[model samples]
Target: MKKIIEIKDFTKSFGSQTAVDNLSFDVYEGDIFAFLGSNGSGKTTTIRCLLDIYTPDSGTLHLFGRPYEFSMSKDIGYLPEERGIYTRSRVIDLFVYFGNLRGISTKDALDNAHQYLERVGLIEHKDKQVSQLSSGMQQKVQVGLALQHHPRLLLLDEPFKGLDPLNRQLFIEMFKELKEQGVTIVYSTHVIDEAQRLTDRLVIINDGKRKAYGTTEEVRKTHGSEHIHLEFTGKFPKRSELYTSVSTTKTAEIIPNKGVDPEEILQELLASDLRIISFRIDLPSLNEVFIALSKDE
Candidate 1:
């Protein structure tokens, strides 16, 4: 696949503090990529630099195999973490206006927005003013607008924030559909579980540094230990080495030692006093990896 986004030694700073430091990564075309980090980890700063809203102190960025230019923005769509809406305008108008900025006509924008509203279950709220809508509703509107011109590259920052469970699932389904159509998406989010489940590849940065990068499984495997979580029917064993930690009577995390397979631990448990009720390998979530790497940093 062609590379859709590239950042090499991308550095950005404000006054005495560096926001991003020596970051390098690639997002391939048609990939559902994730940029993940905590609040002060340069997720938004790096996004702004890509959007031309902030000039970086150093480094380079490329979109669609070329150096980023303001004129090239029409090919990209952005839904920022901080939602922006003209409070006085109707929800439909805002979406149409956003579409207009991306070179879509009023009639097409409205038609498209209507379809999106229908999908988001917010069709009735189209005529309502932005001020009348809740932040979550406004967020839904922003998502509709981002799809106005059917951008080739969608850049979303905290896209699932402020959404209820149903709406969150709706958005996830929406993005999954977009990916199937071959749209390249790079989304920034701190939430780990959802990212772990959906992303094709991800980069986890902490304190403005690249802590981990690659496919979700690859990054997690590289940074943190995988746990064989066991729930037994009796007392746990007094074990060492590969037997890492226990949370309760029936549950524990067993880290495989060097060349020891997780199956070996299960084999040991099978012959122990406890009767096994569950034997499952729990791969470390991205959040787990983040905490481990951040502590080291």
Candidate 2:
């Protein structure tokens, strides 16, 4: 696949403080590349520099195989973490204004906005003022505005923030639809669970530095996390042999301190006359990996 975005040694500093330190990664065309970081971990700063909102003190960023520019930005859609809308503007008017700014004609913008509103199940609120809409409704509207111009690349910063469970599900469904249509998405979020569900690849950052960058499977493998949940009859096997930590009960979870093939571990447990009721090699959840990485940091 062609490269959609690339950042090389991208660094940014504010006076004595550094926000992004030598961060580098590539986003492939048609991939949902997730930017995972905690608060103040430089996720936003990195995105700002990538979007040309902040000029980096050092390093380079290229989009679509060339240097980024204002004209290139026209082909991009951004939904920032900080949501904003004209509080008094009518819903239809707000979408039209934003879409028109992105080169859609006023009439077409309104028509498309109405379509999006209907799709998002907010068509009944079209004539309402922005302030009249609930927080979730407003968020969906902001997303509609960003998408109104039908850009190929979307930069979403915490798109699920402030959304209820139902609304969050709606956004997830929408993202899946967009991804199926080959839209390149750069999703930034502190919510690792959501990222894990949507992303094909993930870049994790901490303390203004890259902690991990690769496919989700690669990262988990590099971290050496064996997500094997084991069930044994009688007493649990000698904890030291299987792993340093093995939770005992109906299902014993063996998390080794070193690399041990889960199959081998299971075989050993069974060979030792340990009645194996059930065993499974569960992949490590992103949230679990995040916690482990954060603790290591």
Candidate 3:
């Protein structure tokens, strides 16, 4: 696979505070890569440096195997964390303007704008001023503008912000379609489940440092523990020295202590006269891995 973006030993600082600490990662062509981290954990900082919006203190940021240049702007689509659009401009006009700036002809730009607006369910509001639309609606327009030129690489920062679940799902589907069409996407987000579902590979960062990076299953195995999920009846077992358990109404998630067998825990529960409904041992989820890594000292 060809590398679409590369960052090697990239570091950035503002004043005395370091925003990104010697981070390095590669995004492959046609892969949906995710930058998973909480706010202020360097996800946005790394992206800005990648786009050359800010100069890095050290190391290299490359696009298409070379340093980014103004000429490459037409090949990359970026939706920044900060949302800014011409409030007084009509929605369709904003898209057409950006399309033209990307070097598309007026007729082609208008055609693309109409197609995008319809796809995003905003065609009915094509002539409405941006200010007349709600924040979520405005965000849709911004997304359309980023995509109107049909760039090969798409970079989105906090793309899910201000979106409702339905709209989020819509965008997710749109991304999947783009990926199928050979568009590579790199998005930074704090939403763990969405990242797990959408990305082929991801890097989890905390305090501006990489904590875990791999396929979701690989990260779960590397940074997560094995646990038993139980749906049961009767009084639940009390916390035992052999394991730790978190439970609600009729379900419990039990994590055995190191070297303690899950079978041993199951036998003990059965001996206690608890009617087990169902039980299965599984690796922790990406969310669990993220929480555990974030708490690391």
Candidate 4:
């Protein structure tokens, strides 16, 4: 697969504080890539450097296999973490203006704007002033603007912020459609469930350093473990050398000790007075892997 974006030993600093530390990663063409990290962990800082909003202290940031240039802006769509729009302008007007700036004709821009608005459930509010719409509505408008020009690459920073579950799912479907059409998307977010569902590959950062990076399955297999989930009635079993468990009310998650068989643990539990309702063993979810990787040392 072709490389769409590359960062090599990239580092950045603000005063004496380091924001990103020798980070390196590649985004392949047509990939839905997740730039994941908790707040203040330098996800935004890496993106800013990639777009030249901030200069790197060392190393290279490349787009389309080369350094980014102004001419490339037309082929790249960016939705920054800090969002702002013309509050006094009508919703449709803002799209038209930005679309024109991206070299689209007024007629095409207007048609595209209307199409996007309808898809995002905002066509009814097309003529409303930006200030009149809710924050999520404004976010939808910004999303439309970023996509109006049909760019080859999309960079979205915390794009799901403030969106209700339904609206979030709506946009997730749209992104899937875009990916099917061959758009390469790199979005930074801390929302683990969405990332696990939408991303082809991911990188986790903590304290400005890369902690994990690979295809979703690879990361999970490399850093995650399997555990048993149990639902039962009555008193839970006492702590034993066979396994460690965490439980609440009627459920427990058990991690068997090394060299211990899950069957042995289950037998022990069965011998206890508790009535087991259900039991299943599964690999750790991306959320669990994320928490374990990002935890403070």
Measured against the true structure, the TM-scores of the candidates, in listed sequence, are 0.92, 0.90, 0.94, 0.91
Give the per-residue lDDT digits (tens) of candidate 4, residues 189-285: 9999989989999999988999899999888888876788999999998666888888998999998888888899889889989899999997777
Off by over 4 Å in 1: 259-261
Report the candidate with higher lDDT, 1 versus 2. 1
Best by TM-score: 3
The sequence of per-residue lDDT tens digits that candidate 2 reaches over residues 194-243 is: 78778999899888898888998888787656677777676677657557
**Model 1 C-alpha lDDT per residue in residues 1-112, reported as the tens digit of each score:** 7999989999999999999999999999999999999899999999899777899888888888877786666778888899777989998888877877777788988888
Candidate 1 least-lDDT 10 residues: 238-247
| Order of the predicted models by TM-score, top scorer first | 3, 1, 4, 2
Residues forming the 10-long window of minimal summed lDDT in candidate 4 = 161-170
> Scored by CA lDDT, what does every candidate get?
0.85, 0.83, 0.89, 0.89
User: Which pairs clash in the backbone of model 2?
Assistant: none
What is the descending lDDT order? Answer: 4, 3, 1, 2
- Over the full model, what C-alpha lDDT does candidate 4 score relative to the true structure? 0.89
Clashing pairs in 3: none
